[model samples]
Structure formats: structure tokens, C-alpha cells
Target chain A: MHPIAEPSLLLNTSICKANITKMAARIRGWQGDFRPHFKTHQSAKIGQWFRDAGVERITVSSFKMAHYFAQHGWKDITVALTCTPIHTAAINQLAATINLNILIEDVASIQALEDHLENPVGVFIKADTGYNRTGIDAEDFITLKKILAHLKDTKKLIFIGFLTHAGNTYHARNMAQIKKVVDPALEKMLALKTFLRKEFPLMELSWGDTPSCSIYNDFYGINEYRPGNFVFYDYTQVQIGSCSMNDVAVCMAAPVLATHPQRNEIVVHAGAIHLSKEYIQLPNGNISYGKVVKINHALEWDTHDIIGEVKSLSQEHGVISANKKIFAHIQPGDILGIIPVHSCLTAHLMKHFLTTEGNFIEMMK
Target chain B: MHPIAEPSLLLNTSICKANITKMAARIRGWQGDFRPHFKTHQSAKIGQWFRDAGVERITVSSFKMAHYFAQHGWKDITVALTCTPIHTAAINQLAATINLNILIEDVASIQALEDHLENPVGVFIKADTGYNRTGIDAEDFITLKKILAHLKDTKKLIFIGFLTHAGNTYHARNMAQIKKVVDPALEKMLALKTFLRKEFPLMELSWGDTPSCSIYNDFYGINEYRPGNFVFYDYTQVQIGSCSMNDVAVCMAAPVLATHPQRNEIVVHAGAIHLSKEYIQLPNGNISYGKVVKINHALEWDTHDIIGEVKSLSQEHGVISANKKIFAHIQPGDILGIIPVHSCLTAHLMKHFLTTEGNFIEMMK
Candidate 1:
């Protein structure tokens, strides 16, 4: 069979290793344990890299993912989702196999779990801080008291403290602003934990999300940290100051398929299927889906190696302009490195990964 | 298993069959043979719906996809990509197995294919009528003519006239405007076919894409039509006037896992994994990643009802809220139907399929 290489994806393992090492150091410096969220990487091989770096505890989004990782010998896992009755059986199966932790935000969900679960699963009450998307209000200590009282009455649930994902940090303009939002939110959670202790007396606060944990070092009352995307930082994290542009290790390497001279555009085989159609609005008001990092035969990233701008994209083609000085050097046979706006979506679309040094890594199971 | 009766996908097979029947009739009425593209639905079982509706030919984006459908008894297929030297062996294998038609725009690519293959294969010259991404420009007809002449002398390639996808129709404001852009571009291809017939006679003039084929009906000179997304219309198709809001059959149904009363937002279990993060900019200048469809009695999908708007989406949750009237009725117990902005990505993400009547139909295999 001929090599199916047109719309192939390339992952920079060197950069990926560096990002993980850097994140490991950052979390260690903050005096916090790093439980990297595997939802961003999804690959067990990539997860193995973290495991080699002494990361035993991990976080996943679904029960299926938990099972997948558990089979791969990941001992401690927190299924980072609100416990659902639909997924209770899977959760039960996973908990029966390993140290599985789950998140619950509602008393009704806790009651359902209390009725059906075979074993006591470690439950973390999802706190709704200022982000205000999932958790119950922290001021409503009565609600927490009611759930804790019910769990205590049933004797079927184990409280592993509280967990909160300060997702609002993603909306911040800069690191200082992200700190301004997250610090107060963390403080609010600490106060809520203190109030909840009046009823349960033994609770911990577990805070996650790469934006808050990657940028800030002060983990005052937070017991555990779960930052996933730091393993493969992208344009968004660079712009947010969570990582430098040089630290962004993984990029979707796509081929220049066809060139359009009439519109001064070159169509790359990479489109939404390879590099997801996620756009980043730069500080200079430039809205680009991705940034071209470097071309082929280059070791380090060329900062000015902005080969082309994506003008339009379809399922199979990314239309880039060849009007830049770099474009004159980039031929149709050249490979272009692109920093995806969102690494999660890009990782999902790919089936395999090609490293910078030409090692082929299979991403799909 | 607790039935997991959250907002889950429910495909109406009868509705899907009827939609295919309607599309086939429209293509026949327009005097074009229906060669439905399978990228949108990506299910061999669903492709059978088109075959049952009298579709004999098909188109796919990649050779792997071509092999995928070919195994399902599809004979006539076109790998709708710019033919490259790297994939010539796989193309030959597929062509040997089925009546595979390949697309090539560059002269060097065609020459490379000519040098590699001994078996006769049908080749369609992909022309850039307006969408300046992949195809050779119409202004470059002299170059195309030279390439065609060279291929004809070899007597191995069967010239199948011109084929163009008016992808610019995707960016058009409305259906009428999309037709205005497509009609002229299609006419240009017909003109190319007419001009080429004197030197090298050709049989077919192919055109496709949901925006052009689904929205407009005037394919007078076009011989074969290919459209995939008509089976599962998305927010993009709804905006382009290809399908009505009711005609959209597939939706990501997710249960409200948590609600924050203070922030007036609720988080659903469905996120980028279930429904892709493809956003649609509404006419009012408000951009939402997806629209909330109707929920059923089982909190699945209802044919006649829908509620709320998805305000923001994260990796594993969709934050939805409407006005006070909408929020007052919404609770943590309810399920919300979310119609994705992009059907292809969303459908691919959902590796499993469930029918409206609750048959667990496996589509990915």
C-alpha cells in the first residue's frame, strides 16, 4: 500500500517532554502534587511519559476513559465529571478495579449513587466558585450540610473533600488578571471548606485547570492540582502567559497540498480534520485559527517563521496565503508546523502522531 | 444500567430514508445522477439508505474512507482529493477493487500517476472556478489542456471532464447568494467541458457540496451531484437555507449535570467530545457554538419542542441559559438537545449511534 501521508498529524515529542517536565517543576515549586488531566492528551503512551515522571494520580473526563487508563495500569484516577446515574455502572466497575474518585455537585445525584453503588467511592463535592457554571453556591452552607448529613445517614459515600475547576481563568486577558480572578475564587473556596467543616469537619479543596494552576504558584488552601493541557501547550496558553511560545511542544504538522496563485493562497492537506478550526484572537486584534511555527529541516522554532496565514478552511484543506517572504521558500513538497489554537480538538481529530525526529507514534487505540 | 436516558442522540430511520428519497428525487429532477458523498453521515448503514433510494455512485474524502464504503458494496467511488505520488499504490489497489475515480489538478501529479500505474483509471480534472483552494484555475486551462493531451497520448487515463465543488458557497450570506456564486462557477466548468470536447471528449460534469446541491436545484449542465450533509443538516446548513430547522435529524442530547442559580447557567454532560466546538454567528451578531434542539419525554429528542441556548462550552460540559422565562422552567433534572454547528466533526466524535426507537446501531465499523 502507498503511504497515506497527505493529511497526517505530527506531534513534537521533544517539546511535549519539555512541557511536562516544566509543568512538573512548576507544580512541585508551588508545593502541590500534580495530577495531570488526561483529557487533553488522551493517549496512554503520552500518559506513560507522565507516569515515568512519577505521576501516579491522574484525572479523566469519562468512565470509559477511566477504564481505558485503568487497563493501562494507572492506579489512582479521578473521573473529572459530575457523577451521573447513566454512568454509575461504569463508575462502579472502575471503582471495583482501582482507586476511582468521582465528582458530585447535587444531593439528588449523591442519593442515586448511595442507592446503587456496591462500594464506597471517593466523592469530591464540585464547588461553584465565581465561575458559576457547575457547582452549587459556596454561600449555601445549608445545602452542603444537607448532602453531608444525607451521605452520613446512608453510610455509603466517602467525602474526599471539595473540588473546583476555576474555568473562568481561560477568559482572562493575561496572567496578572487570571491571578486576580483565581486567587479570590480560591479564597472563597477556602472559606466554604471552613464552613462545611462545621458539619463534616474533614474536607479538602482540590483545584484544577491548566490556566489557573500553570500560571499561579500560590496554592494556599488547595490540596491537589490537576492541569492537563500543560503537557501540550498551544497558541491559547502562550497568549495567556501560562507558557512561553517556545514551550509549546506539540503542533499539527500538515503538508502543503495545493497552491492558489490567483488568490495568493496555498491549500494545505490539514483542515478541521487535522488542525481543528479553533481561532485565537491575538492581542493585536489578529484573529487566526493557528500560527505556523517552523518549516521542515529546522531544529528549533523560527520565531519569524510565520509561513502563511490561514484565510479559509474546509474539512480537508486549509487555505493559506503564499504572499509572505517565507512562502517563497516553502514549496509544495514542504511540511509546515502549525500551533493549533486548541490542542484538545486537534488531538481528537488525529489517529497517529509523527515526532520531530521522525518517530511514528500511533495515537488511536 | 439505569437506562442513562439523558439528552442522547436519536436517529429517525424513517426520516433519514425519506430525506434521502427527497434528495435523490431532486437530483433526478435536476437531470443529474446522485453520487452522494458519505463524509457527512459516515455510516455504511446510512449509505444503504441512499442506495435504497437509487444512488449507484459515491464520493469520499480519503482512500481509507473509499475502502470503508467499498467494503459495504459500493462499487463506483471517487476519492475527492488532489492525487499525490505518495498515495498512488493505495489508489491503484482501491481502483483495482472498485471503479475508483481520482481527482488531480496539477500536471506533475498526473505525470507521476501515469508513470506509476499500468491499469486504466478514470481521472477528473479538478478545476478552480471560484473557490481558490485546491483545483487548477480556469485561467490555467492551457496548462490543463496540455496535461490532458499528454494523458490522452498515453491512452491509460480516461478523462472524465471537469469537477468543481463551489466551497465558497459556505461563506455566502444566504441560499440565493450561494446559488449566485455556485451557478456561475458551475457554468464555467460546463464551458470548460464544452471547449475540451473538441480535442478530447468527456462524459460527466460533476458538482457537489451540501450548500450548492442542497440549497439550489438548477444543475442543468451538471451530470452527477454529490452532497453528504443533507442527511444530517447542521446549524451551518440551517443558516445557508439548505435544510429547515426541523429537517436537522441528528443532535447531541446531554443531561443537565449541574446548575448554578446565582450565575443563571447550567452545565450539561455533553462537551466537545459529543458535540464539536464549531460555532455559528447568528444574524444578531451573537455567536453560539450550537443551538438547543427539542427534548423528548425520556429527555432524548422531541420532534416538536426545544429549549434554551448554549452560551459556552468546555471540554466536558455545555453551559446553557436563556431569558428568565427559559431559566425559570429549566432545572438540573432536565435534558437539552444540542444541534451541532458542524455535523461531520460531531458525527465522527460519536463513535456509536442510537436509533430513535432505541436500537444500538453500530455505525463506526
Candidate 2:
């Protein structure tokens, strides 16, 4: 509802707060620590909403983000990615002021962290529970033992627990598929915890992925949850059965630049630079960049009134393929709300958000 | 490269200057105005490079960028995207000081601009040659005549020319295919120009697409050329045969965070945020977010020594699928250079550039 002239990220605060409240209550009901990932919104102002929901600990993707939130009073922080030794200075500075935790996968990284760290930091052995993107394979016990044995000699590094991001759930198309992808990943993490309990009896288990966290009620023995994207469930999450369209809190308000009635398409000011190039393959063998929704004069959108889909994008242009019913009502100066395929990337690209109540939320640059 | 602890954009200034010189000379050889699009780099310091090559006019995609460049002394500027009525205030302010031009495709937009204009501004009729993204179709003479007739009643709008961005050339896999996509688009533009000359004899023709401009020696009858990405050709351009690997002036210097020897992969700090999530599909049915190049002790990469390819990307992590040789040499502390798939999006994401010579070039935020 803000007076936006250009492509702007519109955040529905009520919906965002409800999402946080529901997730926080669910995690508390399961007796798990909810160190929700702050990488999705990257706004210190939005961090206050999580704090209102009784979340104190947080997870960030980068050292810079950790520092940003630390400056905003987030004391307990975890950097979820593998910590490279090149950021030794940043690690030492951040660890000196807060309860800093970093993920480590290989013995080499553990050794590198131990050699350069000037302050103590919690280390989580990143376990690969099927998302083969990064982290130590759950079945690779040799590397785990080596990392544990090497950490035994370290002065600054404190082994905390095992952590896994079942990112493969992002590829799931339905609730059953999501469960199929996550059940095995959780089993692997639990198995690894059991195997390592002989030497590391106090170790905790950390598992988080938006789909699995949103769908399942019980987390078995996992001690902590760190899902980020659930805060702003997008078109992709809706497609993956992680969350419903009603839970989506963020939408892009883009101005229509031109309309091509013959082609049944309208070009908007939003593009890859605004919404990100992430896309989903539709059932009709077409790729959709985002789903378009009608914006009322009050500048609010209804999730159920899905009008069209963004068929293509360039540097600063998004072409939405629309049907005659909706296309007839659209004009060059009209504004349309688009639910991005991936809200995390969209938030990152927009760098800020305008709440529906006309307040601007500043994010880390 | 410049003591980077995070993913950083690295610019080879020599290669960038060479790209500018070559493109300027070729445009001059064809007697066309070289208004290189500043949206690729969006840096005032880099704009100096174009000015040094005798380029006074420039093209940008947004009003914010047009204002930025105008402040930096760029007098002749064309906002290459369709102008919306919502930005009338910005348009009036910008056009009040500079020789500003905006693209218009329909009579509605022209009416909106005319009704809101407080200063004189040049207008170009956007013609959709083949991209089918925006603009009036070249064969849609009825609409063209209607727009021209409507513009005749305008007080502050000055008709400039017809402009077309043959973006279809981006999908071309080779130089021949590039020509195949551009030749007909050029013919359509020429035919439209000849027909429009009956009433608008002094109208100009502006055509721009990096692939077409870089591959073709002659831009017959086109009065102006505005190729933006040719300044920093990317992996997509190389695959499109617009330029060779040597022409790519920018590379992302990302810190290696973890190495998975069993999977022959390494995780880097460069991810979707750093690389813009633009990818090219390889012939082997694999998607490459970027091509990995070896960075020596001097932080210089040899185009011929491509070490691997970025197979997947998350928010802040890039998974490089490497061979045993490259995987064996990589460590958590090392820094690797990744040539991005699309330089424009990458440059936009990285707000500044660190030249190989260690100087930071600031861009418009």
C-alpha cells in the first residue's frame, strides 16, 4: 500500500508475524531450540518480530550477516555454512562479543580454524544428510572421527553438535515426496549422533529445511531447528508443498510498462535484477519466473486471485503471459503484485521491503 | 584478489578498456553512434572509460541510473526501457537538466507522458523486431500510425526514432545462428523505417543486442547502436559466439569454504547472490552457473586453464564440480576465480568492482 514508483518488495507484516508465531509455537511444542535462519529477510527490524515470538538465537549464511545482526543485539549466532580460514579476523572479532558458532566439515578446515582463531567459537560438524551440496557424508565415519580427534587438541574450537540441511526437500513436488526426502536425512543425522555418542555424549543434533520443518510435527531427537525460507514462503515453496499461498508474506509490486494484447503478454518493470533468476518448471512444460496477482486500488493483493505467470525476464523487464480476462483490465501504468518463485533471492535482490502499513524495513546491504 | 574475505567482483581493467575500444571502433566504422549502455557496469568511474573512447551519449535501464550518469556529466542519455507514468516527477526533474530520451510503445503511455511532462523530452517508438518481449510489432503499422498521430498533438514530447532490442540473439549458440536471428530483425526494422520515412523522414533507427553488435561487421542503416554487455562479455556471450573467453573482463573471486574429495566437488562462498543465479546449459545436459578458472598466486586467471564448473548454487554457496586434479589442489583457505554466466547481472549484484590493480571502482547503489 506504499506509494511505490519503481519495482518494490511489499511485505505483509501481519502475515509475517503469524508465520513466525506459528513456527515458533510448533518448535516449542516439539521441545526444540528454534535458531531460525536470518538470511531470508536480512533485516534487523524484522529480527524484532522473531524476538517478540521468543526467539533469541539466530542463524546466518555469512560472517557479514552475523556481524550485522550482532550489531542489532542478536547475541547467540550461528554461521550455517562451512567456515573458511580466510575469515579468521572476522571470526575472532565476532566470537569475542557473542556466542558465535560456525559449521566445519573437513579436518583441514578444523585445523585451519584452530591455527588462526584468536577467540573461542562453537563448531558444528556439518553432516551431509543427502543434500550433497556440502558437508561431510553421514556414512563417512573416518572423516568424522578425524575431525573429532583433531578438535580434541584444539584450544579455541569447541565441538558442539552435528548439523544437516536437507536441501533436497526443495526438489520435492508434494508432501509425500518431501517426507521421502527428509525421513532418510533425519535417520542419517540420528544414526551419526548415535555413532558419535560413545566419545561425544553431549553432542546435539541440528536439522532444518523449510519443507520438512513445515510439514512434520515430530523431529525425533533433533535438538535445534534452523529453517529460513518459511518466513516468506514463495511460489516454489507452494509448489514443493512446504507452505500454502496464504502463508506467503512477501510480494513484488511491479509497474506495468507495456501491454502486448496480440501476444497476451504484459511487460512489467520487475526483472532478474529485482526478482532473481530462480524459476520453476510448470506442469504444462513452461518455466514460470513468478505468479502474478491482481492489486486493488488500496495496493493489497489476494492470494486466491492468481491472474497470470511471468513467462520470461531480461535485465529489467518481466513478461507476464495473461489470459484475456485479466489482460483486458491491465494498463501500462497499473501496478501488479507478483509472488516470486524464490523469496530468499528476491529479498536479497530488493535489499529492502515496504510493509503493507507504509513502513520501510531497511535490510543489510 | 584484493585481500578479499568474501565473494568479490574482480575487473580486469585492461580487458575492459580493450573491449570498449574495439566496440567503439567497429561502431565508428559503420558510421553509427556508440551509446554504450551503462546498465552493465553502472559505475561512474567505468563511464570514464567510455568517455575516454569518445562516447558522449549513454543508455541506462532506469531513471535512478539516468540521474546518476547525468550527474557524472553524461549529457545525452536514453532510458532504454518503456517509461511509466508513475515516474513523471523523476522524468521531469531529469529531463529538465539533460537531453533525456525515453522509450514509448503505445498511445496510452504517450498520452500519460504528455499530460504529466513539465520539460521537453525526446521519445522513441519501441518496435518489437523479434524478441516478443515488449514494444509494438514492426508489422503493426496501424498502432504505429496511431501513436505517431497522437504524438503530433503533444507539446513537450519530441519524436526521436524507432528502437528495437533484438534480444533473441542471446539464445543463439553460434555466430551463424546469431546472424540468423538478427538478419530478419534488421530487415524488419529497415522495412519499418522505410515506411515510416513517408511522414518521419528524419527519424533514426536504434538497434542493440550484444551478440548482433559483436558478431556483425555492419549495422546497415541503423543510426545508433547500444550494446551494453559487450563491455564485459560473459560465459553466455562466449557460448553465443559473441566474443571469446578473453573478452570477458570480469570474474568473481570466491573463497573456498569446503572440499568434498569423494564427490570431486568444492564449495565456494560465491552463490546465487554473488553470481545472480544466471546459468548456461552445457552440451552434456548439465547447468553451469559459472566456469571455474585457476587463480594463481598473483590473482590472475588464464582463460585457457578452466579448472571446473559451478554445478549448483544456493543462497551463499556455490558447488563447483571439479576433476580429481583440481579437487586435489583446492583447500578451504584458497581463493578461486569464477567467470559468471551473465556479467550484467553479476555486476549489478556486486555494487562495486575491485580492479586487478587493487583499486575499488564504486557503482551506483
Candidate 3:
């Protein structure tokens, strides 16, 4: 019943609910609007858990996801990733029904929305505070002004505020390094918010990134919070000092296929197709695809006792370097719990989750 | 219609058919049973294309895949990965209907199959000739004898021959390096076959690995050939000299989201969830997630003109470092074709394929 004879993504509901409640209260304490991102756990049932925790608005990364949550009755939905012209049809459809928001960085995107959108929709100028992944640079006021001017002429598009996902915090090694990324990002975002406030007084400041939201308490100038990964934190967050290992709510229960005790290795059925190829480089210079822990009698992983690390992965096989104690005690049929390096990718690959209570939660397949 | 307003896995059916024909003819020339592994494409329609090329039997990586191909009229099927007890239910079900073969390396796995299998199934001893990923070592005769003895006592398991996957050939840089890995693997496999043939005459020799099968011509003693990646040769295959870039049959049609001319980068809507996180290291010490090529008027990629490389990927965004010419020509709504690093992982992540002729090909979900 636990491992289910195949690779299963196990979700601890108690831990997940606690995570949602804590983050909701923290954002409330900062006096900011809590619009938690739903990209991590794309499930309607999990969304209800957030609803129970007083979260009304949520963020997603794609138009498909926006349409999914919209169908499931999420009213205030933001497609957090930048908008392209190709998704205009979806944008128009979602905007027709829900309180939809989309991100825009340039005049081209705004022009696309104006050209095709039939219903009014909220727009957030995606600003690159520091992470150079996407979004317009916060200091690039020329482009920002041009986008804003174009949005001003549009009848169907409403400019909301500046939104930035400081994803650079993911690369931070510790709390101090996370602060190093967050402090400048906050400054740039705050500066942009101040500049835009003269014209749009109600323009909100949206900050998202799990590390900054989980580690730093001071959300001084931010009006909205949108951290996604805090719901089911993983080994990467623990490495970044965003959360402890105990806070991770998901684990991959994989069946042991074969063991090479001479090589101190055990092969599991779960591989890149199950847990994803995301890995973490340890301080000792070893790469860990995932951390292995034991499943207790209650079907929960013993986070206090990490038994091994997944060393390598092929398409459908994971090679784990087990400790002497576990390797000696393990057999080919035993199920071992593997805490994935990145929970979002793992959850996406898995497509659904199995709660510890033996209930299946469906995602947006 | 080309990009379809979202990331689509574009399969060039002509190139794919040509790859199948060429590989089928080469294996015929070597007088080996061509049971091409269907794990790469996983599509039933693509399996029909193999039937068109005169391939009767097939190889898969899992029990689920075996069930899928068996449903589509494949009679002789082999699940090439090591068998575990947890999958005995699927094994028994498949074996009861089709001529199913399962891989076994240890006595424990054999015992599991022996205890639960209701119908007689063919069993192949997976030998670790050189790749230490899984399977029994070729030199471990004592353990092999024990496993054979356990199988001898079983009523429902028929002993097939030895099989090995020389996956080490994937790490080879050139033909010479590939030969270096293949020669030792074949020698050890032949040695094991020779030693076992004294007791079990007419035992077949099965060998599978895309790199060795694509590069080396000589399959002297191998009775079966199982190469999966040749169906959709990827960037990693090109780097490993398994196939040229022109032979690659699939490309990800990703919609361009934004262009950062200041940074010489263009971000596309496809990311790890669409294209997978597998990467290749260039000779210059830079990492390449995928190679970028322009989509031509025929809805196929211009493989000759390598335009850029996907420098990095996040959850739903791939940042491509494009050349000046392509960058200038590219816009926010344009579609760029990306040849993935590993086609199997990419295909798995994509879930289905859209043929160049505007046809949707379904895979096993």
C-alpha cells in the first residue's frame, strides 16, 4: 500500500498544511497581500488547503496552468511568467471569466494583448531586479516607460504593478548569501515601485522567490508575497538555508531493483523520468541527485536519518550509494524514500501526489 | 500552426523512417535479430513504422512499456531492465498473453518471479560486461551458478541467454573511444556465453546500446540487437559520434517569449519540464542544455546551420544564446526548433509527439 509497486510521490498533508499556515501568517504579519504561487503543487485539492489558510489569490507559470486553476474556481490568478503573443487566445478566454493577471516586460507583449484580448485583464510589469533570467531590468526606465505608455492607451488591459521573481536566491549557499541577493533585489523593486507610484498610486509591489520569503522576515516595501516552493520544500531549499529538511513535505517512494553491495550501490526503479535530473553539488564536491531516507511504520520518511544519496541516474534507473548499515539491511523488494533535490520538478514529473492518509490528489494533467 | 501556441515536440517522420530503415538494414547485414528498444519513442504509431521496416520483435525498458507494445500486436517482447518482485504482477500478466522476456541478475529476483509468475516466461541473465550500472558481473560465475540453479528448480521460468547493455559507450568521445568500450564488452560477453554454452546449447546472446550499435559494424556472436536512441538521435549522440546532427529526427518547437539583445539571449517557453534537464559539456568547457536550430518552411529544422544553444533552463523557461543573425531575425512570437541533448528523456517529458505532417502521435501514458 505504501510504495504501490511503482514509483510514487508521497505527500505529507500535515506538513504541507503547516507550511501553508505559517507562510500565510508570516505574510499577514508583514501587512502584505498573500498571493502564493501554485506552480509547485498544481492540484485543486491542495489549493483548497491554501483557501483554508486564507489565501484567495495565486500565481502560476503558464497559460495552461492559469486555465486549469481557473476551471477549478481560483478567481484571482496571475500568469507569473512573461506573456507572449501566441498565448493571446488563452489570455482572452481566462480574462473573460476570472480576475486574470499576466506579466509583461516590453511594448511588444502589451501590443499583443491589446490587439487580441477581448476581455479586460490585469497586467504586471515583470522587472528584473537582479536575476537576469527574464523580465526587463528595473533600472531600464526607458523600456518601462514605453511599455507603460502603451498600456495607458489600451482599453482592455489594466496595469497592476511591478513583479519580480528574484530566482538568483536559488543559487545562494546560505542565509547571508540569500540576504545578499534579496537586499539589492528589494531595493531595485522598491525604487521601481516608488517611481511608478507618482502616476499609479495603487500600484503594488510583488516579490516572489521561496528563499527570500522563507528566510527573511522583513517585507518592508512589498505589498504582495508570491512564494511557490515553500509548500513542499526540498533538499535544495535545505541547502540554501530556506527551510530545514523536516519542512520538506514530499518524498519519492521507489522500489529497490538490485543491490551491488561490493560497490556500495543499490539501484532503484525511479530515475530521471520520475524524480527529474536536478542535482545538488555537496560541499565535499560530490553530486547528489537525491537524499535517501527510510520510511517508518506510519509511511513517513525519517528525515533525521539520511541513509544514502542517489549518485547517478539513467532514464529509468537511479544508482544510490548506500551506507553500510542500510545496505546490509536492505533487500531488492524494499521501498526506500528519496527526498528529491527540487520538489517542483519532481512534482511536475510525477503529475500527482499520494497523501500519507492514502488519498490520491489529482493535478492538472 | 507550426508552433501551435505552445511548446510542441516535433517529430520528422521522414527522417525517423529513414533512421529505422538504415539501422534495420545494418543489423540485417550483421545477421542479428533487430529488436529495437521502443523506450525512446513509446508511440504505437511509431511502432507501426518499425513494422513497416520489417521489425517483428521489440525491446522495452519496463513492464508498462512491454504491456503497451504487446497491446499493439508485438508478440516477442523483452523488458531489458533488471526485474524486481514488486513488478511480478505486471510480469505475470504480460507473460500470460505474449512471449514476454524479463531480465534477471540475482537469485532474489528469480525467486520473486518464480513465486508469483502464473505463466511461463523467458528469463535473460543480465550480465554487467563493463557498465557497472546494473546486472551481474561477467566474472561472477559463483553467483550466476546459484541463480541458474534457482531457475532450474522453477517451473514457470524458461532460461533465455545472457544480455548486457554496454552503456559505457555513451561516455565515449569518438569512434575509437566507442570501440574501446565496445571491444572489451563484447569480449567479456562472448567469454560468458562460451562458458555457459557448454551446459545450455542454443542460448541466444543479446546486446543493446545505441552508441556501440551505431558506430561498430561487427556483431560477431550477438544474436539480438536492441538500440533505442537511433530512432531519434539527439545532440548527445552527435557529440558522442553515434550519429551526425542531420540524422537527428526530433526537435522541440519552442515559442520565443522574449529577446534580450543586450545580453545576446532569447528565452523560450520550453524548459526542463518540456525538454528535460539533460545537458552536454562542450569542448570549450561550457555547458549546453540543447542545440538551437531554425525551423524551415517545410516545418523541419535547418540542421546544417547551427544557430545557438540553450545556455540554461528553469522550470518553464529556456534561455538560448543565439547568434547575431538569428537573434536579429527572431521575435517574441517566432518558433525556434531545439534539438534535445537526450531524446529519450525529452520525449518522455514531452509525453506525445506531433509529426511534421501535422499528425498527433500518442504514447503510453
Task: Show model 1 residue runs off by greater than 4 Å.
Answer: A1-4, A139-142, A197-201, A295-304, A357-365, B5-8, B154-156, B172-175, B261-263, B297-300, B323-330
Off by over 4 Å in 3: A1-3, B1-3
lDDT for model 3, please.
0.90
TM-score quality measure for candidate 3: 0.98
Q: TM-score (0 to 1) of chain B, per candidate?
A: 0.93, 0.98, 0.97
Question: Which of the two, 1 or 3, has more DockQ?
Answer: 3
Write the residue-wise lDDT of candidate 2 on B1-365 in tens digits: 35779998999999999999999999999999998999999999999999999999999999989999999999999999787778788889999899999988877778888998999999998998988888888888888889999988898889988999999998899878888888889898899779878888989999888898897875688999999999999999999988999989999998998887777888899999999889999989899999999877666778888778999999999999987887667788789899999999999999999888888899998
User: Model 3, B170-253: lDDT tens per residue?
Assistant: 899999999999888898888877888888888888999899888798778999999999999999999999899999999999
RMSD, candidate 1, Å: 2.8
Model 3 docking category: medium
For each candidate, give the interface RMSD after superposing the true interface residues on Cα.
Answer: 2.2, 1.3, 1.2
Q: What is the interface RMSD of candidate 1, in Å?
A: 2.2
RMSD in angstroms, candidate 2?
1.3
lDDT of 3 at A14: 94
lDDT of model 1 at position A111: 81
- Model 2 lDDT per residue over A49-125, tens place: 99999999999999999999999999999998788777788899999999999998777777887898988999998
